[model samples]
Target: MTDESAAPVSSGRRGRSGGGADARRAARTATTITQAGFIRRAIKPYEPFTDEQLQLIEDNAEIVLQETGIDFYEDEEAVQMWKDAGATVTQGNEPRRFRLRFPKGLVRSLIKTAPREYVQHARNPANNVTIGGNNTVFAPVYGPPFIRNLDEGRRYATIEDFRNFAKLVYMLPSLHHAGGTLCEPVDVPVPKRHLDMIYSHIKYNDKPFMSSVTSGERAADSVAMCELLFGKDFVDQNCVMTSLINANSPMVWDGVMLGALKVLARANQACVISPFIVAGAMSPVSTVGTLTQLLAEASVGIAFTQLCRPGAPVVFGTFAASMSMQSGAPTFGTPEPAFVTFGAAQLARRMGVPFRSGGGLCGSKIPDAQAAYESANTLWPTLLSGVNFCLHAAGWLEGGLASGYEKLIMDADQLTMFQKFAEGVDFSENGQAMDAIREVGPGSHYLGSAHTQANFQTAFWRSSLADNNSFEQWQDEGSKDIVVRANAKWKQMLRDYEAPALDPGIDQSLQDFIAQRKAVLPDSMS
Candidate 1:
């Protein structure tokens, strides 16, 4: 009745036995000895999913597709193709409808073909970034100021703002990924926006960068431009581009977004399928109901990508935040934020796909006590639950509507601290510290011992923010609020930051291209 019976099983047996000892010895001989082995051994086991539950999710998605019908083919030609494909259609006089029909077999195929894990490449080969393993964290530039003109939105963004923010990103040690076009490039017109923003990205940072996913034509153009700059095989060899595909829940994939996916897949680029399901807005109020809605949306995206290109790199981008009844907008930091982060992490593990969740989004007005508490608390469950990659790691404010430089610095510090915690424990023979303990004797101090000095750095977690200064020194220097210190640090980075050198001709060419594109924009847009 179901393909669950055909799921592959691992060949090895678990548990300790005489055979286990021999097998371990053989593994060691094959150069497979573990380093800091405790972390490797300390993983929480995955929970089993019942066949009935899985089927329910599939059924839910089918119902949503048939009942709601996703909107695609904003263009006329694509609409005609859908009409030819036998989808129910209304004539030009009436609004068009797009109902997707997905069979159970298609779902299974998508699940089987999609890669569970992969790396995004950086210009420096050593900086290759991996997802779906041991608290591996990556931050992308977020906040495009979707709703401009509000008091909070006035600071939405400008080209100058984006350039300065890119400079801040270049200096952040903890932000591992550069999200291309971090800000909306209002300077350029809609048609040429991707090219100009991408130029800024390549010129600003050498980190692994995400591709802007605005529309299909732009998506294709962006990929082509990247190939022009970096050469062909850039996508496959380097895994250089990762694009976002947002699905409207309970069921919807617009044509432009779906077309963007096809473009990225054709280029062999990775994707982060983000389903932004707002509870009580796009989904039900109950958490379980919301999760079900998200799962259905995710299933559709997975199926589409696999159909387009099998074995495509895909990360399950679950950015679930509940709607605030008081404000009538999506709330970012709350108990629900923790639930969203934890549940998404677990789901990613179950599906064997990398999970993407937001970080440092406190929704606070200014960098103050509220911001610190909200940020620090939201990330713990995400880290402990083993999320593969974290997006929006820094520079978010007012529920992800704005980016703050001070907030970015604070978040960078928090990210570094989390990485240290995720390092877990050491399990090497010497790391056990039994021999050293015996040598030092039970009652005597280990502080002055050779072993203590040797292992001190490894033994304890260190904080960049927590003050360890003596009272006299602190008094002399004048204790400052974290926000004050963070602002100062932000200024220092801006002053000292150096742009990574690019190929001499490439920079000039990119700038010339940007200038040429900018010249064509209307005076109002410019």
Candidate 2:
């Protein structure tokens, strides 16, 4: 199938040229962001666990929390809060360590105050995403230290790369959230980079975004920046930001994460209480064992958020991956992890909270076949498992050590497909197409029929990065693979990036705040 609306390809040119009226028109049209809404899933989620099985997991998780209590290391405030909440707190073997065990159903009762669903308001109201119920929000890759592309093989990510990614994600209509820490800007000082990352999200994109979670001070700084942009009153009353707070696996809630959670929760910002589990390493090797541990860890983290402030929004998140028994390297897109995601979603729903897990996760070092297959495997389960907020939905590569430019484009292209798929079948009057069938009786063909002409343009989803032309047309137009096409596509997107309008006063205030913070905060390379 060919689109007549598409600009005519010049056989003489290898790649699209930056000249000609038709070419310029097409470029402008293509670069314009499509008005895609957040996915409200029409299909039912895939639930694999029986009621008995789910109860068993919950029972085991409560036992883990009660018997083998979680250690809150180096946070007296957190320990005191637990003690105040009726939990049994005991002195730990090490200094600044405290173990707190909840009675049966205590964690569950505490988390009951969290909202089942809530809106994360974007700078543009139209871009606001609802997390919970049947909605699914997609965000780009987060927390990669290095960047990779066809041109630049692999290198430490810089602020420049971080901003470029922000621009790309903003342009891609499929992605709903401007993810936090798209990549670590190693070029900037470690202490000061969070300011730049937070600023990039506010300056480059208008979508809902995450704030810093490195420390309580940085988290407070994030809330302050939001107050500058969205007003302190509004920030205190509404959910404007959603941040990631991972649990140190093997049942540990370290001070760093607990402190960040407290800051965000008190400010009414959403927090994803995710457990970072690598099966057989941080968790048990068996799927059931891993699920039990994930529930226990997530329970404590989510409950802690409610303790900070009742009714603060929190997601029941789990990041579980299987590890190679021989090499001890983490694996992704495996069946066991998929099962964990499926089970965890069920568990989250039972606990009355939004679920967060799954992404375009893989262990591949490059955007090759391994990356494509592994990413697809993970993404399929993510949608089916009813993931509410999907981070790392695009641009993941090298086991999440590096972010791939081509891979981001490729993953986002697939995300659009997923969005379409989540809509399910139309089944409307037009979908039946009885008129078109009668007009093209005896299988003559509907290509020229009135109904076909009217609906053909919107009927099928078109891929921006895929080449579906015949071999002759493909070869004539420079037989480029998906990776090469993706490379060119991202460069073109950056070239056409247009920053969303921000109030001059607010922008200046943000700049001043960053300047003041940098002046006071000591710079560190670590």
The candidate that wins on lDDT is 2
State in Å the error of residue 256, model 2.
0.5
Per-prediction TM-score to the true structure, in the order listed: 0.81, 0.93
lDDT of 1 by residue, 1-526 (tens): 1111211111112111234443344334331111121111145523333456555655665565455544553444444544453444444322543454544344544667777777776653444577665546557447555322212433546665666677667667667777765667565566666775676666556566777687776777667556645666655455677767888665666667877887787677877888887778888887656666676677667656666667878888877677789989777667765665666566666677777776676667676778777776666655665666677777666677667767777787777767666655668887798878887997898888878888888677665665688988866877765666776777676666555544434444455656665577444542
lDDT of 2 at 378: 98
Give the alpha carbon lDDT tens digit for every residue of 1-526 in model 2.
Answer: 1111222211111111234454445334433456588899999999999999999999999999999989899899999998998899999999998888999988999999999999998876778899999999999999999999999799999998998898889889899999999999999998899999998888778789998999999999999988888877878899999899999888888889988999999999999999999999999899899999999999989998999999999999988689999998999999999999999999999999999999999999889999999999999999999999999999999888998899999999999999999999988889999999889999498899999999998899889888999999999999999999999999988777766555545666778899999999988787
Worst 10 residues of 2 by lDDT: 7-16
Distance from true location, Cα of 97 in model 2, Å:
1.2
Worst 10 residues of 1 by lDDT: 3-12
Q: Which parts of model 1 are misplaced by more than 4 Å?
A: 1-59, 62-94, 133-135, 144-156, 185-193, 236-238, 470-472, 515-526
**Residue 224 lDDT, candidate 1, scale 0-100:** 58
